[model samples]
Target: MTGTPLTTILIVDDEPQIRRFLRPSLAAQGYAVVEAASGEEALARAAEAKPDVIILDLGLPDLDGIEVIRRLREWTEMPIVVLSVRSREADKIAALDAGADDYVEKPFAMGELLARLRAALRHRLRQAGEAPIFRAGALAVDLVRREISLAGEPVKLSPKEYELLRLLVQHAGRVVTQRQLLKEVWGPAHVEDTQYLRVYIGQLRDKLGDDATKPHLIATEPGVGYRLLVELAGDAQR
Candidate 1:
């Protein structure tokens, strides 16, 4: 049998229709689903359900969705996917910064949502130090050997650049905050050094053959942090 147990997805939305729409979709994918209608219930059910991933709605009847994300982050790192009608960039950034793993606006395609959910889960597994090789499209990162290659060609990176890329690869699909990256890569004393990330990220993108204007791998979250998206690369599954 499989080493990992069945994954439970917690749906936190005040709208009955929303829950109904998601339940069967997730169930069809063999995921056990738990539903909560409000922020308070979301918190309680999250504790009771012990879900592996969470799909949260920001416009809850009681507490704001961001608040739910914040409270949950305090105790757990369960992958959270924020589903909301708010398409504004600021709202998306806020939810992400509050600890949501992915954000999908309302009227979303089911396929995209499912893909994002999978990425979120994959990210958590990688962050647990469970993976040695990470593959994103033609780019491959061999963490054990501290090597990165693009399309079979070895890409050179500075020590700091490699460290940053390694960390991002570990949490591949998740938005890693600037503070966390700085602290981890530059030391705790440099937590405020976001410019370091700006420069390094640029250098990394250039080396990885990624264009900042139309990035296929590393995408900026704008005012929050950066997220690496390599869906076509299979998100390190291989």
Candidate 2:
């Protein structure tokens, strides 16, 4: 298969055999693979190289995987997939809270990992604004341009924030469940952290200047998830 022209991935793990196993597979699928053996090295490589995606191992020599993820989140928005032997629900939640986009158990199938990678890339592209823009009241979202404006002034969003908004906008008028949001935003391992969803949604609403008591564009579904109310009359093809 022909590789993605500009796609690159970083693999961070202490095991040389794991790196050796993943290098050729990712390369075969058209991704440029950069390897790091420790958490410190991973941070340095991530800062300098800025890979499009990261496949990280949770157990590292210098630091825990969650710390590495948190440190990376402080500076970058790249998709991070955590690979670990731990399968506990709390462990997964911690990783997601720290900013990992996805998590995979150890001894995972290569095909499944590739499929997850593809899904992540597709979701990223969609959020990056590959469709027509939409407008509602004083709020305008330029999907093609990947920009949001409130009353004509630009609204800045972090990478994760933008992704979350795009998901809402794309599924306007529907009640998106908390599990769905977590799965899409923080990956499959984070479907249970409702608090994270609440916090992020509050932040988004605040940033958009929407009243939490009476939101115009975003709405809460009580015990469920959130929804984006599309007031625009026309079909905004996306």
Q: Which candidate gets the maximum lDDT versus the true structure?
A: 1
Model 2, C-alpha of 235: deviation from truth (Å): 20
TM agreement with the true structure for every prediction: 0.81, 0.58
Residue 149 accuracy (lDDT) in model 2: 89
Model 2 ranges off by over 4 Å: 1-4, 130-237
lDDT of each residue in 20-61, candidate 2, tens digit only: 999999888878889999999999999888898899999999
What is the alpha-carbon lDDT for the whole of candidate 2? Answer: 0.78
User: lDDT per residue, candidate 1, 1-238, as tens digits?
Assistant: 1235679999999989999999988888888889999999999999998999999999999999999999999999999999999988778878876888888889999998998898898888777867788888888999899988999999999999999998788778877778778888999999778888999999999999999898889988776678888674555765
Q: What is the lDDT of residue 195 in candidate 2?
A: 90
Once superposed on the true structure, which residue ranges of model 1 sit more than 4 Å away at CA? 1-5, 178-199, 211-214, 222-224
Worst 10-residue stretch by lDDT in candidate 1?
A: 229-238
Full-model lDDT for every candidate = 0.88, 0.78
